[model samples]
Target chain A: MTSDNTKPWLRAEIAQWLREGIISDEQAQRLLERYPSTPEPVEYGGGKGVFASLGVLVFGMGVMLLFAYNWAEMHRYAKLGSIFFGVALSHGLAALIKDPRVSSSLHLLGTMLFGAGIWLIAQVYHFSAHYPDGFLLWAMAALLMAWVLPSLSQCLLGCALLTLWSAVEVLEFNVLHFWALAVLLLLQLPWAYWQRSPLALTVVLMLLALALLVNSWHLQEGAALLHACLLAAMYLCAEHFSPRMSWSGCGSVFRRVGLPLWLALMLIFSFADAANIVVQLDGQTGAAAPLTWSMLFVLGAAWLWVLLDKSLRPRSPIQIAECALLLLPLLVLAAISGGVHKVGMIMTAANLSVLAYGVLFIVRGTSSLDRRQLVLGCGLIVLLVGLRFTDLFESLLARAGVFLLLGVLLFLAGLRYSRQKQRRLQEQRHV
Target chain B: MSRLRAILLLLAIAAQLGTLAYMVADKEAIIRHGHTVYLRTLPLDPRDPMRGDYVRLAYSLNQLYPSRLPGLQGLVPARRGEVVYALLRPVGDGVYELDGIADRAPESGVFLRGRVQAEAVAGEALRVNYGIEQLFVEQGQGIDIEQRQRGEAGFRRSMEVALAVDEQGRAIVTGYRWAPLAISVSPAPEIDGAAATPRLLVQLKNLADYPLAVVDNAEHCGVVLTVVNRLASSAAAPCGRYLVSREDIIELAPGAVHRFTIDLAHRRWFVDGGDGLQDVREFAPVSSLRLVYRSPAALQEASAEINLWRGELHSAPFSLRGFE
Candidate 1:
């Protein structure tokens, strides 16, 4: 047999061999069918082209008719009828078109034109002091089109417009307008599922949540707070349920970066709340609430550290970073309770804890301490120590002196690392 | 190559034409057309100056209403978008009746009606209930006269009417109805030679269409000199003239004529040639003059002024300063 035919025969022989004893019947069938003959490419510009052209013409004519009728000036029902008819015609055309290229392009153009046409009709009606019933229709059509196509541009436009319309309706004090936004979010889900588009889904969800928050704020204060809390809780739940579904990164990096940031914000808010309570109490009863809530959150963070230590893998950066974050709130609480004088004691303890963690991380370098982890761990230790001295010194000049000393230590460390690398390279060359 | 370019050009033209056609086809029909007249009214009750003499009237383009469906509050809230018509049934002297109804719902309040179904029939009207307290006559017939002679007793009148809006959005006001207000006209003594300058001259003539009475000591009004252009070294010549009661000038009958002259040359003074002439040359100035009259009843006071610098004529600015 010729070279090409030899390859095919060998594939058949292997398939028969697998079918007999080695591989299962299912495996043999899969291998045999894998090399099916290629189908002929589809030809363009025939009956299909004619049909598509006809479809476009029909859709365009329908748009013209809808425009001529001044559907916007008609009653709400009539406007809804016209919009539904127009959208149905456009979508029908999209489905009937056989060629992918023609289908996509036609779908884009037809939907856009239909949307713009409806918008124009509404505007005319509004300006003429007539009934403007086209807005609802346009919103619905845009959302449906977004789901049908799921093209990036279409989805983005539809989402943005629907969100804006919802906001406008809310401002007009119509609570029912939120349904349109809900519809848009629902439409996005299918596209997200189909493409496995996690990033897109996240962004769209965040935007939807934000819209809900803003609308709630306008409608009711308690509602706004509840909505925001729900959105944050949802994110946290999502992170916990499927850790791999976290789009940001692997577990360690996200925990190390995300935990400290989350804790810091919580601390800031707690402090602000405590300050307000103290001031208010001083004005009224001359007794503060003892910063009890803030202290409780701090204690909660400590409990979280102990829990993480037991649950997480030892020497995990996430475990270390989470512990550090959990300790930070406690430090702040101690400072607040004992005044500035006790800050130095808290800082010293934190510094020693951080240094010990850093040394442990360095020793575990064979597994986790890459360049980034090494820098982050050691840098954090130095930062804690430096912050302690700065707080203890209490004067700008003395603080600057402490920073200068820390900077010298970092410079020496970097120099020593480079020297060690050079010695290793030289040793390798001599050997 | 040229054919391809031509085809592109044709495509662009076609697209533009399509857009233009769409816009034209979608253009909103002008449902109603009417005039808006604004006027100030002074209330007859003397104790209430807060009810100023002038009442501003507005003729709206369209009246709007909420969508008729229940539970649709705050949706399309602006009422200026509904096609509305007002039916004015004549009430009595100085007052015509007003019943505003939308073309879509006749029983509705006089407010604009919106969201009428597409299949709605004609003659359906909506009512708008503005709850306005008073109505005044439309403005536009009697001439607006600024100054009248003291003790002059005659009447002045003005009128306007709202048009009827039909089911098909047609607006029609059938006949010109009269809105009349009675005013007592009076005449005042005119000063001689009020304007006699070569560059500028002003002549006051009695042009009243009805009989008027002129009185002496009817409270002489002051003439304000807005600007004095220059002071001649010669004694300041009278730049203005005021009649000393009724004796200074003859009483003017309807259509009667009067004249006055002011000479700017009399005020010019030739001093020692050098410094005095320089001062005079440096001091070129302009002046404005206004005529003011006060009535014995304290109700008929008016002023007329002319600017000398810009040579522009201006009426005395109306003052509600004492009303409230």
Candidate 2:
């Protein structure tokens, strides 16, 4: 039988790699022979995962809606029995079926049915209201199904519910809360990373970490600073993990959660009274954690150190300016502690840092001829300016002026982008 | 590895099914052969006994204070969620009183095993949860049970939990016994040279066929009766607020009455004799009294576990009434 080389793109990729001297000629030939040229088999795409998932979702929804309606007339045992049977039947089907899509979907459906049965039992035996024990049971059952089936979607479902379970746990605030979320994180983190789902990983990590931080640190303002720094460090790690670190690009991932938090803290602290309010709020819970400030400083400094020494070496003036962004918060904090009259100095420094970061991004994008970054960078400056205007001036006239300025700036940026795109298209034609 | 996984999967399924099977078996056994005892439950918003989707069954036996269990002297307080054994004494045909408490299992008689929940009602009462604290009913029946437990006119409805306690003191909440709860307040004549203010005697009778065991009952705090004026105002006088724990258990026998005395003798009323004002009892406003407390009652059920629900053996709520 001839070797199956149905996928010609593999050979094309090998050839390209060979041309680029990434692989030896002999290696390319070996790859080619390993996947030989053969006639393609005729096929129709059947039982696509999406369709199966969609069908199951629709069926599950129908079951939920049907059962949700006036089942009060039915025997409690009957309702419980049906839910139990559905879970057992779906799982039984999952074990029998070999088609991955069908099997995984069945597992997902079974997991959901199991959760429904848990609530059914609760309803049958009147459980407590506003209790989270049911959620814990539901999460465990879903996670168990996910583990047994090794289904990605089931794992995702488990993770999402687990997060909700943790959130519900906040009311009780048991010491066990931290451990449970952490355990779920350890269990699901691998699946998220293996799937290269950055968004999912980001969400899970953020949730688990935030829950742990809040419980351990008791939602103190200082904890927020540490939490932001810790997450930013993780995002930086994810960004630096590899070139193909994510299914989607990992550009400015740390900024997704961290930069906004930093900016928010800056904006909030930019007001003269916010710091004293935060201190008083901290007093209500208990003693403010003694090492909170130290933790914030250590984690923040570590992240800043990593960014400067390891990731970006500040070889150019623009890079050096970006590095200075890390130091600005510390300066702001120092100034605030000194007195309230010096608040404008910190605010001006903050505005300058934001302005510098924005301009640097815009210049970098303009130089590299990248459109998205240009829009984003210009957008940042406009947003910051608008925020500053609102914070500084309460009057409608100042607000109107801010809005007019933002509109003109955006219009100019858009015009410049269109012209740049045209010029780039002409350059490509000339090439 | 796949073989190991298969074994683990089987084990997990087995364990889950085992838990469910065990729960069913436990309840069925208690309902079939366990000894029956009655519990007196108070109306917790009888209009909607079923709060949301859950029927919250609060038994009189749920709370245990250190002072209540006198025999178990120096009984180490059980940590929250720790299981403690409580020995019981039959007060009458169907009701039981807490005799003693122990860390280990009880050998014989009507007793109960319960976990320690944090105290909810006034810091004095230690909350003990028998497995039968909550029962799950069908979706809409929660409201129905709640309403039935608290019939119209407020005090006419109450819930009686019949627990079947096995030899081991393990309990199953087999059923609920329903009855009416009523209160009547009357004046008690003052003795010669008795302090000017007379004592108001509020009598509450067990209208149910079974007896009821109550805890920390002296000064009639177990059955709280509040006095209100014509202004529709409920005032907290020293008489009503006075709570002295003289004894732990008070048994209201079947067809028997339990009397509570509200002291109005020591009231610091004011008197103005057209000159300067002096303290007098004449203006004190307590006229008619409304019984305000949820009477706690006890029965035992048979279940080795804690906080489970089984409603098959339940009876109509036990009734209480007061007469002039």
Candidate 3:
């Protein structure tokens, strides 16, 4: 008898063989029985989950606002006791409820109440704490609740709270809080992996990028170049690790988020003012902070590792362009450190790189028949041309001629692409 | 959930509750056992949307002039946002003044732990922030207290904050009281010098029955004078930063008056301009003048034996017709 793990195609071929008289009917039947069709999966509670989550969100927000009302007339202890009671009661209800969605929602409500309790306690005592400390404690509570309840919503609340903590510190106090970043990497990253949540991981990636900027904000002069390199590195790292990731579509998601970020950074770098900051004019040369050098080195090493990947050789023009794009900032960085201060040359190089990447994307999209890539490519090119036309060129006649040429070229490309697509379809139908 | 998981969940909840309970207990303990002290302060109406309306409590202990302490001249400077310990010595019943500031916790003394909001060079003024700086009142009640603190007529000095400072130097605001102080401006009868500017003799009086201290330093000065022109435009003397010494503070007995002169023709008078402050070289005739005094200095300078009065006041508008 064939195993149950037998491929569907093998069973199909066997049935066909029996019909063609290549096998006896009994043999085909016996083989087919071993590979019995698995039952279709039953999806449960889709609408229920959505409604439950929404209810949780609304209920949480209401509870927070109610708490903020600061029941001033009530006895302080009574207020504190009521908040404590609400948190425990919601959490207890969550424990009793057997439905997963309802239980998760209840847990979320409990966590939100718990946060309110912290602030309520603060209000009751008229506590004038270092304000960020409140957020840190709130984040800790949410994270701990997330861990205990194993709830995704709670995890998200924790992430948001932690980000708020870091933001308040960096923006209000102008202090770079490393502990928040450390917690994100060490605690939240693992939680994302544990939950196998691609969305959570993406949020973690974006937050990490923000945290990196905040942490290295002291490196004012060298910040842009260092950030550009880091952004490119993140993209490469995501691409390289996507396949090995446990969850499906993780790589695609990373690329979807990362590509635009990389493009935006590169676009900004293409401007002269931003580019010249890589080598300051006032004579303080090199990366201003040692951390900048350390980051550049780490990013360089990561790129090298990705480049030396034995399985995926850079054979395609698009892949080669990507590799070059990754190196462009570092090359500029090196030039700056080596006393090259030609601002015009750097600006030209940055602009040309953006133009080259735009063209590469268009070519790759056309060949691969990916509409999203094609749209992105066209958008990028249009943005570059639009920016240049808006500010760079002064001659209206030259601008008009360029626009006319661009329109004609785009029209011809679209026409050729449609013809090729039509021919391919016809050939497929004939075959 | 299994038994172990249930226990773990209980533990987590207990841990969170414990953390909150610890905060409550900590503050309660301070109120229970900490030394009670009165801080001089004035309030302005400000609201925190999340936490309701609060009267921003500007205390006299907020800024300490180390220049007053000749002994601290060579000590290491505390940078902004760095931990600072302000040693406070009681000058009267339930009133303490800053004795000295150290970067570290003092070995043994009654002190309030603070952060250096602004660092000053040696022998200059540095600002210290005790965390209990904000007094969160009931929603909308802040404006009432603020209004009382900035009185309607000629007086504004009123609010007195009570704080409990523990041995560890942490503090929590406990309560507030009202102590009114007054400022009066009148035309000066005498102009001695040939080139003397037209002057007004201003008086800062202790309207309350308690002895009070006034900041007479060149920096903040005891009182600020503003001249209102006929068009309702006003020009104010710019407050300067000068070394504050023991002599800078004048102790006023109950119902006592301290007098100062304001020169209307001084180059220092500036009016608000579109770009910035514009020099008020001249003024329109028949304009009225007003004097305002605000001090966020300690109510008592223990070393100087002066009980500093802290509050903001606006003098009743005085007519400048005779002088002009």
Best by TM-score: 3
Q: Please, what are the lDDT tens digits per residue for candidate 3 over residues A302-339?
A: 66776787643454455677768757755666566556
Runs with alpha carbons beyond 4 Å of true place in candidate 3: A1-62, A69-71, A221-225, A281-288, A315-317, A337-339, B1-7, B70-76, B89-93, B102-110, B122-124, B184-324
Deviation of model 2 at A416, angstroms: 4.1
DockQ of 3: 0.39
Docking class of 2: incorrect
TM-score of each: 0.38, 0.66, 0.76
List DockQ for all candidates: 0.03, 0.14, 0.39
- Where does the lowest 10-residue lDDT sum fall in candidate 3 chain A? A1-10
Please provide, for model 1 over B1-324, each residue's C-alpha lDDT reduced to its tens digit, 9 standing for 90 to 100: 256543543343234234434543433222233222221222111111111121222222112223332222332332432443443332222233233333444443222223322222221212232212122112211112211211123322222333333333333222233222222212223337352222222233344454333222312222121212112222222312333343422345555533333222333321122234322222333222222221212212221121101011111222111111
Number of the predicted model whose lDDT against the real structure is largest: 3
Off by over 4 Å in 2: A1-80, A125-131, A173-176, A213-229, A243-379, A393-419, B1-36, B43-52, B63-87, B97-105, B119-124, B153-155, B164-172, B180-324
Q: Between the candidate structures 1 and 2, which one is better when assessed by DockQ?
A: 2
Q: A1-431 in candidate 1: lDDT tens per residue? A: 00011233335445446645888877777866754433222222356544654565466555654444333235644554454455455545655777665754465455555655554343332222211233444445445555545444345545655666667556653443456546645766446545445434544665566566567656443234323433432333232322223232222222333334332333222333323322222211212213233334445554554445443222335445545544553455334433433433433444454555455443332122134545755566565555456335788888788778767756655565465445445544654
* Fraction of native A-B contacts kept, per candidate: 0.00, 0.12, 0.38
The window of 10 residues in a row where model 2 chain B has the poorest summed lDDT is B306-315
